[model samples]
Target: MKIHQLQALVASAETGSIRAAARSLGISQAAVTRSLRELEAAEQLPLLIRAPEGISFTEYGKTLLTHARLVLNQLEHAQNDLARFRGRAEGRLSVGVTPWITLTFLAETVLLFRKRMPDIQLELFESLMAVAQPLLRAGDMDFVIGQLHPSTATQEFSCEPVLNYETAVMVRRGHPRQHCRSVHELLDQDWALNFAPDGQDALIEYLFTRHGAQIEASRIVRAQSLGTLQMLVERADMCTWCPTVLQTAPLFQGQLVALALNEKFDSRQLSIVTRRNSTLGGAARCFIECLLQVIRKHARSARKEDLALFDTLTLLV
Candidate 1:
């Protein structure tokens, strides 16, 4: 099948309608239908099942769509690489970051990268680690910043550990349960949970199950936006689990408090990940270097502040 036919098929699958796909591609609906029919005939498999709601991919159609997306991504990467070689740092860099990092670290990193590579276009997609990993593997994202659990260690991506931090129960200032000394003490309190099927949610569920504590799934207020959850906790008596990095700014500002968990949860590593076998263009390389520098600077600043705090505590003691 022709490359355009494959492109049309991918667009149709994504938009779920031939008319929508044609509009996106700036082509006629008839052309889109013809291209899709030709692609299906050549493969001897129906790619889309048009229904009243929209189009759905069959099992084989799903497989073909996956490969089609990869092929298109590779072609786009090649074009970008060629453009980069002509002494221009101009190309789109799509990066995915977890919701927590989007609020905590990504803003500064993106600002620094933009200052360095002014011509390069940057797009950010915020999602949970589970969603980001597959997109990275499919070449949909050039990089992702999120937790690297044991399961991700075997993946075909290079991960650079950036931060190791404790997870704590967070609440607004003067939260009654904040003074509790044990997990059991706060067990009855309502909790706002990130309830995604993967990442920290899965790990938290596993830990709770091991402890024979039935997770209060009903009390779980699913949140995908970190800021929204923080605000909800600030206004209400709800508590949520989050990393120390998220608490640092608010804690310093006296807007939030982090209660120490009775049993220390294992530290989660924040990592910057990229495709293992893919070659990064100059702009991408520059952005990565800038990000490393920003992380190093932040880490150094945190160490200095920690040392200062220790000195003050020692003097008081």
Candidate 2:
């Protein structure tokens, strides 16, 4: 019946304890308890069971929590819409991005956004799509810039493809196997990868099986951070499958090179996802535009690089 009651319920469900929820909401524990009790009385169901280990949701409580999340998200979206109508670009804009998408290009985009909307607060989350999805559904994030996967919840969000993300095998410049021509030749070398539920792992498995190469489990490094993976490949005799867009990074300019592998790699699409039919605020609209502009600029630079390489190959011919 009331906003505070729903907030208390959702916060407690998320934090696992009324005390923690109260602290997070910046209110007294008694106030949170009162609001939660009020919500339970209105709904006529026991939502949370309190115990020595803290509190947990009952089956009925879980159902309520789902609807509570939707209600909260709708409220925030309405607030955003109202603010936009009032001709105000003043609000917190939270965006989630995959780690691979965070680079100098993203940094520049954020910086330029700040210059244009000094009144808005920009919050950035570098997390996987699996992690970012729930937060977006809960209205904690304005939108997400990440890859679209087969497992992605298509019914809950609207997605627009931003660019095609192509990957390549990268190693430190002048590695011993740099001159190797086949995936089979590099099976003995150590490997690093960013693990996700997406196609990367399946593709890797298929590549090894198809080439009759067996990679030792001990030699395979599962890296969650892109920076860590980059350093691992740069400092050791290691190789990683990486996004070709990483070529724009100065840290990798002269230190890493994409191997001329005989096998082809799969390309995936990156997209911007927002809640379906949710109208965006001016700030959120501007942020998406900035991301598109950065991608266009990077595409232009990549095209020029490809042209130069083509000229060099022509000279050889």
Candidate 3:
């Protein structure tokens, strides 16, 4: 199919109607309609369902939209590559990042990357792998720097280990169960779970299961965002399972503390995850390099007791 036809499809999907799509693309409504009709005829499938409210994608249309997004994104990368080769620093780099990176090293990495490629626009999405996977597959995001569990680290993406750190059951200081020493002790306490209950099992749930216990359904609070989770723990007297490193963040310092539990979880690796077999643009590559350098710098300055956390600093690039 032609590039404009794919563009029309994507625009229509985003804008929700032919006229809106045409307006966004700076083309006439008739031209957008013709493109969509031609695309449907070429594919021999009905891609859109027209209605009084707006247009909606058919099953076939949803399937093709993913590929269309990838094609358009790759074209943008190619153009950016050419621009960078000509020594012009301009393009957008979208990334999905977990909270730990933002709390620790993301600011330094951004500063370093900016000094080098000052004109490249950056879009940072605070997202977990479960939320980011589809966006990465559709080319709506370039890469994700987040925790990658083995179960979800499929072959569709390349996961390069960056830092290894542990998790903790955290709560506000002086909570009733702050002195509790086991995962079992906290089963009766209220919990703030940041992940979707229907998706992959949450870390907190796994810990409870490992201890041969289960949290009651009624005692759990679903926290849709990091801020909400933190607030729930600090103000609502709810406990949460999170990266141990988060205790070092400015927002959590003194406001929250990890429970002294006897159980220890295996280290969770922070990774720079990207699509396999995809070519990263110059700006993206440079930003990754900046991240690695900042990580190495952190490793160099860390105390002796903290060196073990940075042990997996092997360059997987």
Candidate 4:
């Protein structure tokens, strides 16, 4: 029930060791143990089970940890509110974003935000939409900017569409399949998949399977970072499906090109997801305004280049 006890619980669970949790919280090891004991004593239940390897959370421990994070996040927000009321420095704003959003609007937004709100701290986490969903739900993030599939965009979250675009095949310039027009030609080649979203993988599987390639079982290189993905595609024969906007990535440096595939990829809808019915703080709203502004500006700025790139990306079919 105590805030420090909840903080200890979260820190211990995340760090996987009581000593490490104490170090993270800048408290003594005994304090961490005492906090955990207090938590369990109040609930009259075992929260964590210790073992030779490390401690593992019990079912109740996991549940409490989830709430603990939520409570901590709420407290942080409250602190931010109070700080601003007292004319102190603005508070921290944590956001979860997808790579597409990162490569598209995030940098510009950060730059603009810093120019306007110099005191506000910004934290950015980039991952797949699926990975960010749990982080947002657990209150680790103020908002999430990512692609939203219809099936995964549940009613629990409110989704506001920011960008809508289909994906395209990305490859190094002068690759053999540039103008080949056949999906089959590229099937046997190794690939880089940045994220394994539900329908995203299925579309690739369906196409390869339908093309008499039977390559659905073949493992594609999974690249977690944009630079790695680009490096793999540029230095090797690997290809990837990516947003056409990715052409703007610094790693591409005009070395990579977006090719039109013979078939199609599922539609990709980029949106901002927030807890459904949650009120947005003034700072959060301001951040969204900056983000949307950047999105629009990037779209406008990329229009001419995208048109040129789209015209060049072609499959013989």
Candidate 5:
């Protein structure tokens, strides 16, 4: 009912215990216990199961926690908006970005954003759309600029395409199959892919459909992080289909090489993804504008450095 009551519940859930929640909230343990009891009494349902180890949410508590997070985040956004209108640029902005953006324009965007809103707390997470979706839905992250998964439903979010995501099969520099020109020639080798749960089948289909080569799932390794996929490709014969931007990052400078297959994979887009119908706060809006400015600036340049690194980038902006 009350805002503080909701905050108490959320803090308890996040911190995992009553005493920890009380400490985070700058309140006494007894007050935290009282708020939890009051919330439970108001809802006429048990919200938390307190134990010596920690506090665990009941199913009811789990459901309410989601809404509680949304409510709290929205309230913070309202406060931030008011502060911005009063010429006070101070608020927290949480955003998720894929690896390519970091290698390309994120540094420029951050510098631009910080100059305008120096007091705003910026939190950046290196995440794929699959990893960032739940946080966006729960209002834990303000937005994400990453590749959108075609197989995943996005009716709950708004995705605005910014750049076309080009990909290629990559392997270690001296791997035996590195010179293979056809997908069929590499089917027998191990494959490591970094993709969403539903995106694996689609990527696999794209990689092999041209050659009509069917790959067994047993030969494929599902990678959760870019580091893991990089390790697999660099240390072993495992090959990966990833953003062509990897070829430009210093981390992969000489260790990895893209296979020049005659076939091309399906096109994906890098988009600015945010919750549907949600108004972005001041810090979030300013950061997105900075990101777009960098993208547009680079897209218009004909410098040799830009051409070599961003040749495959086709901007939708």
Candidate 6:
């Protein structure tokens, strides 16, 4: 079968629909159908079983899909290697990011990279961690930056720890609960939670339940957008858990305050991730190095701040 036909088969299998596969491949539906038909005829087997809901792959189709993925991966590697050898670090690099980091560091990273590598194009997709992981494995994204859980670490992907931030309760300045130093004292307050199937909210839920505190399900306002959540916290008495990066956000200038948790809760680890076996081009490698440098700089600044705080405490004593 032709490479295009094989690619169509693989895309259709992954997406579970000809229309979606066609859209992802940037081709017409008719063309995709024609390619599938050609492949089926050449192989003399029914690759897909059409159903009312969507398409399902047959046994042969399943086997072929495994081979298709390997072939496509090798082809992509060859292309990347050739581009590198030609001294043209030019190809579309897709990146996945979380909402919090998008507001905190994504823009800065993109701007800095663009200034350095004007020829390299970038496509960014933002979503929750669950969605980002699958896309990264499917060759949809060259790399991703966000919270990395233990279950997400697999043989195909490698994660590098970038930074860790404590989850703190955030409220608007002058909040009545801001004076409270205990988690129990703030439990009655309404919370704006990031509502996702698998996200920080679930982790918070586990932590509360483990401590014999039941989270008020009704009081949890679901928010998928950080900006929207920040607005809610700014305008109302609602509070939410956030990382320290939000403290530097300009949206809620002099309005937001992060309350320390009474007992130390889990800290989220931000990680930079890429395919374990995939070879990165020069541009991607340089960009990664720059990101690591920025992280180091932030860490050094944090150490200096801590030293200053210690000095002030000594003088007060």
- How accurate locally, in lDDT, is each candidate? 0.71, 0.75, 0.82, 0.75, 0.85, 0.71
Tens-digit per-residue lDDT, 125-191, candidate 5? 8876667888888989999998766434357778888888678888888899878898888888999
In the range 1-317, model 6's lDDT, one tens digit per residue, is 88999899988988989999999999999999999999999999988998878899999998887667756755774686578688865666677887766754566677778876676777888765666777777667778877767665676678877666656777889998887776677667788866445565565665466666666777777776666677788777898876655665555546778787665566677777887767665666666766666544444455654433222111100
Off by over 4 Å in 5: 151-153, 197-203, 209-211
- Comparing candidate 1 with candidate 2, which one achieves the higher TM-score? 1
Pairs of colliding residues, candidate 6: none
User: Least accurate stretch of 10 residues (summed lDDT) in model 1?
Assistant: 308-317
Reference-based TM-score, model 3: 0.92
Ranked candidates, highest TM-score first: 3, 5, 1, 4, 2, 6
- Candidate 2 local lDDT, 1-317, one digit each (tens): 69898899899978889899999999999999999888888889988898989999889888878778777766775676577678765777889997756754578788778887777878999876656877887667878987655455467788877766667788888899888888888888888876554645565686676666777767777776666787789887788877765665555657777788888877766778887766666788889888777656654565765443222111100
In model 2, the Cα lDDT at residue 85 comes to: 78
Q: At residue 239, give the lDDT of candidate 5.
A: 85
User: On a 0 to 1 TM-score scale, where does candidate 4 land against the true structure?
Assistant: 0.81
C-alpha lDDT of residue 191 in model 6: 84
Clashing pairs for predicted structure model 3, backbone only: none
Every candidate's CA RMSD? 5.0, 5.1, 2.6, 4.8, 2.2, 5.9
lDDT of 1 at 139: 72
- Candidate number achieving the greatest lDDT relative to the actual structure: 5
Stretches of model 3 off by over 4 angstroms after superposition: 200-205, 302-317
Instruction: Give the lDDT of residue 180 in candidate 4.
Output: 62
Model 1 TM-score on a 0 to 1 scale: 0.82
State the lDDT at 19 in candidate 4. Answer: 90
Candidate 1 differs from the real structure by a C-alpha RMSD in angstroms, to one decimal, of 5.0
Candidate 4: regions farther than 4 A off: 15-34, 51-54, 130-134, 197-203, 206-213, 248-250, 275-281, 298-317
Residue clash pairs of candidate 2: none
